[model samples]
Target: MKRIFVLLAGLCCISCLYPQAPATEAILEAFENRSRQHLLHENEAYALTSFSPAYLFDTLLPAAEARYKKHPDTWLQVHLLRLRANAASNHRNLNNNIGIRPESVTLTEEAIRLCHLEGNDLLLAETYFDMAELFNLYARHEEYITMLTKAFEIADREGHDYFPGILLYHKLAGMCKAAFHINSYRESIHYGNRALAMLGALKRPPDLHTEIFVYDLVGFSYKMLHQADSSIFYYRRINELLKGRDTSTVFYKLWSAIANGNIGENLSAQGNAIAADPLLEQWERAGIGFGDSANISLARKAQAANYFRKGEYDKALQCWLFVFEWSKKEKHFTNAAAAAEGIASVYRRKGHVDDAFFYFRQSQVYNDSLTAFNNRSGLQAVQAKVKLENLQQSLANSKALLKVEKRSKQFLLAGIVLLAVIATLLYNRQRLKAQNRLQRLAQQKREAELDARKTKEEIENFVRHIKEKNDLIDSLRDKLSSDTALKARQDILEGLSEYTLITDHEWEQFKTGFAKTYPSFFPAMAARLNQVTPAEERLATLIFLGFNNLQIANTLGIGRESVTRARYRLKQRLSLSKTEELEELIAKW
Candidate 1:
């Protein structure tokens, strides 16, 4: 850092009275030597402060200027450009620290070219990381994300980086924080927690001030979750830690004051306004930058609780009802839940149990959602970091792949353009060749599509034709079954005809056709009819069917007792014992 030397030079002129200490001179010499050898290794990326680059340019420009004044040299001028580039890049990084973008982008690009010209991967990665921040500031999220992701890959491969606690890793995480501001709070929580966890897994915590700010952010995130109890506890712990570490830290006052006020509200809900009042007043102070109305909802909640505990239900309900209105404006889950729950409690005491039950359930559901939101938010951070890292790696691979593909496409495109130009030139002399090639390509494409279409059409046509054949068969069958002319003949045969009212003429043929279609029907009918027979002779006569008595008996498969029993069952079924005869029963049916 030539800046360090310039300041030393200024101090040296005034050191007669102050006395430049030997240790300070030794430090100056070391810095001057180190600045001379800048960008020689990757270690400088971590060890070099922002001031180092400016100091390096400050020391080198004069030397390079003095060298050129004597005689011009190519190497000297290039080296000066290189130093200037590094110095400009570091300047960009400082601008990045202060939230500037376009200037940072310009400086980062220059830095990368300088590094590339000098074959420096480590400095290039740093430059690229800075470029990512510029894009992130502009809300060019996809491109910005792509850039750091590339740097992360370079850092992993050729750039010589260790994970987590490094400045680059935090830079990657900081880029991810842009999402959080865009109401991508879920992603914000994810990336923030991932950054925290990565550092945690790094075997040692970073003592860096930037990293300490990350812890502050994490603690504040819990409060936003409306987990007041958990929020208060963590904030109390962080507040104590921050005070012990940096007593003058402004955020310590700002965030911790808010956290303390939140805890007081929680206590107030359990019915303690006296305790909460002081914390609310502290947050309401001008130095904290918090307005009185900002915490009025909390004060109202405390007042409602005090009234409720005093057994003044109407006054309590009125306070809680106002709290309910205030909570909506506040839109804070803890304050809202407390407000709703307080209203429910007042209703329960007033003996409106049903209303109390409804509000009570609403309160519980909101409270549980808040808890799950907080826990899941933290876990999501871990997952997002993995995803971010993975996405970064994927983007780098994609870039490299894109480069190869782009180059190949460019080559192919160039060839295509050249071929078209050649074809254009040849058209005057050999038009047929070009025409044939174009036609062949067109025809091939058409044939492929035609084959696909034809195959699909053939399958559809075959299915349609089969369906038509089945329809024709169904139509013919319907015509035969519904024909009325065939049913008009006496003792009509209905096999190939229609339903008929038949007579005794041609009854044998009718019976043959009827038995063919209804073979089992007759057997069941005969058994039922035999039970109704009035005499043993008729039961035997039904089985006889023009056979001898022995053959008939065998066909009936009955001893004389069953025949006699059948006759008795028949007489009972016919409601006739002595009045019924076999011949009369058969003739009647």
Candidate 2:
């Protein structure tokens, strides 16, 4: 009887050590229930400060691990993996750092493998959505688009609605916001329209949270596009929605004030300050009462804009200057840029070119700072993607090796004496496969090299043709200078000069050819040399094509000294150091 009791106690201890399948399922279900609430409430600060997924992940980690060990290949293990990945991704999303992002990606990939194995489209869609957000936050716009596309396809094919559709809309809004930040207002409006259309197609209206977001994006996008009437239309929609609402909560009050403020700003922009002032005053009072400094600042800026439009120069200058200082001090870069631009405009109107130029440069500096942050994030995103691909390939190779081993074991068990022959056959098959792969890769490399060489030769030939034309023109000019037949020589010079002169159409054709041959060249050069003139761009292109000053002069029908002076000016325009070789820089570019 005592021995039976001991055996029963040991069994109970074992059961306690590893949670049962039912208990694991319960934990996952509870987590999913909480996830919906958390997703809704996940504002800017929620990820770092809230305790849903992060803390819950810790609490369930041991149980999940034990359960996964007991049922390594089950759906429950996939859920555990996905939950852990969510926790990791949330942690990474709180900051722009990519250090911890790869771990999250690994966990997500593991979950994805299980999802594929189990044929769970819903979970696969969700995983893709998570990864899309990860990519978007890190500035991997192309990857974000790809992931979202895949997720939407899966969800649509499987008839999964609501959350998947909402996520698609959310990412669309994010893309719009990103476009807007880069001054791509048309793209922002395009995306905003698409998102709004999608929201309208849903069988049910979106929750207030989602509706507000869409309204803000569409409204701001139109505002940025300078479509004041359209901007006011959307802002008024938000106002209509909030008209009967209780403003007891700070969230409601904040949105309410923002909507009112935007409407007033648009009205002011449309030259209706009388109508706008009341709404602006309403927003100002609400903002100050709610302690919303951003809303208050925007109202102040709008008031300054109104003053400027009303020809109250002193008040406008004072107000704009205050806003500029506040924006700089608070590190509100976008506002700082706008304020600087406004000051620059005012100074220009007041005939202060130097002050205008200085403020314009300041505005440019702030705007460039915003773009620089995006560029840094894009670099990190690319690095993270490369790391993920390497890790995933490694995992796939390991799985393939294990699968081959299992098949080999099955074959060997059929007959031990046949092992050597089977091993030789398998080795020969793998060798052939590898050889074929290598040959394909080698062929592709050769084709790419040949194509590059051919393109270079074509460009060189074109430049040489231009040089020949210039040489012919110079020879004609020499004849006109020395010939004794005055009338005939003068007529020859006129015709030859006319022949050498490039028309706008011909110049455009040449530029088109250049662009087609070297697709990335002009855009890259233009970005490096901001606001470069057409003449400077043409000179830079010629300089890039291994042209000497004399060759450039002949090609453009100018003197060699003129070409030299142009080069010097270009160096200054590009802010190149004296030690830097322009030719070498252009070559690399």
Candidate 3:
């Protein structure tokens, strides 16, 4: 009898471990049924990407809620709430709502509370991540960061293989990429690398979609940092990974075209415009084939930049004009502003000062419009108040006129004169306000132009000084080589070589000046700084300053072969491909 009791107790314990298995299975079955009834590609793994809110609200959420009500289980409740929150959030996003829905936040918070109450770390971490996603959708970045940090801490402590580890890192990478701040790109690359490492470490065949997205994010961050070789390397990796996949599918074609365009852009930036042409053309063709207007616009902009860099001013102007018109028509102020700026630059290069100034002002107008739109709430409130005051004043004027009319003719005439005076005063006030606003804008534009010219002059002066120093060193080396007693004066030669080499103090001054012009340069190089030797760092800096191999060798007091070897070693340390030019990479920096 005791043996039977022990066996029963063991069975009960085992059952307790999988208490919600049936409930989970039921929920999944309902989900599958609903997806089959509504989704066109129900059996596909990515069917949810095309999910409609109606399906979520009318079918999936309803079914999940019913199951939760029937089962009265905390796990089921949490699952249902998560689905509900996702549905609400998706609905808001699809409708292009200004902010996240309160219901979505509430549902996610309740799910989190339930998870905490149940002591389920995994569930709590997932819910926190869900909350983070909701915050991200609304661009509440601080809250998003907080939620993600909490989720990561919990997931790290729990040691979950995939739930929070891979997913959280991927989301963190994406978040950092979209942050649009200095150091954000490096942070993005850092997280993206981590995510990629985690994906590779997985025992199972990793999700290709997640892996590709992380690669794309990292590649884009590199591109923004002007690490062209690194950018192209990762983009090419995407293309390689997509091999043998269905070429006709939107997913395959979209990513493939994006990769091609990005690689071409990087190549063009590296001054390989001829090599980039075919790739850019392929990307543009794909955009046209897919009828994607945004992609077409982006491709045109990239082509314009390439042409502009290659001194094809006419071609650049044509492309910029097209983008400008299209963007204006679409009311995309940001693109319109960019196109206008490009147009102005092209005109300036062509020596069309008036046209350049006109376009510059046009760009400014578009920028101002964007600024106003971003602050539309306050502007709207101010406008509303002005309208209300005008209405109230008009009402008062009407009452006064009525009272004057009831009095004698003299009073009526006086009232009419007083009203005319008031009207004149108001007209003068509005005209003065308009003039003042225009004057302020004009002054701001002039100041901006002056500041830009000053910065350009300063950078030119700095570069010229470095070139002059290098020229002097080169001259000294030429004289030394021709010296008859050069072998006997070995100490003098060494001193000259030491003078040519940049000392620590000189390097500090160079960096300070460079940082003034390109503030993000060092920050972008921060990740690789620790790994590179001091000589390699100097080589990179010289390369970035537009120094050639001969000039770099002379500057460092080394032979050309030594410089080449150092460059090759640096390239390897940086993990660049053989075909990727180290010069192109460092010069971009």
**lDDT per prediction?**
0.51, 0.68, 0.68
lDDT of 1 at 389: 66
lDDT of 3 by residue, 1-589 (tens): 0111101001101111221334434434533332212111211212222233444455556766777667666665776787777667565343345466779777876776666555666666666666666655555555555566667787689665434233444565545544422235676787677667666554444468767887988898898789999999999999999999998898899889889999999999999999888888888888899898877887888899999988999988998898899899998887789899999999999899999999999999998987775466345435534643563366456556656766768777888999989988798778988899999999999997787667657667766776787788778767877784767557666666555555688777766666666766666566765655667768877788788887777677777898889888788877899899876766555
Worst 10 residues of 1 by lDDT: 6-15
| For model 2, the run of ten residues with the poorest summed lDDT | 1-10
Steric overlap count per candidate: 6, 0, 0
Ranking 1 against 2 by lDDT, winner: 2
Which candidate has the top score in TM-score?
Answer: 2
Model 3 lDDT on a 0 to 1 scale? 0.68
Per-candidate TM-score against the hidden true structure: 0.35, 0.52, 0.48
lDDT of 2 at 57: 52
TM-score of 2: 0.52
Off by over 4 Å in 1: 1-123, 133-146, 156-166, 169-173, 198-212, 222-237, 243-255, 262-281, 286-589
lDDT (10s digit) by residue, model 2, range 1-589: 0111101001101112333344444554433433333222222112222223333355555666776676564555665776566566554244555433677678867877766655566666666666665555455565655565566677678664424345456656666665565555676677777777787665546567667777787888798778999998988888888877887887778788788888988999999988888887778788789887777777778877887888887777776788898899888887888889989989998999999999999999999986786676567546656765674577667668778998998887776757766887799778988899999999999997787677677667777887777777777789677964888888876666445344567668678767767888888888888787888877888888777876676666666788889999988888899999998878877
List CA RMSD, all candidates.
32.5, 33.3, 44.6
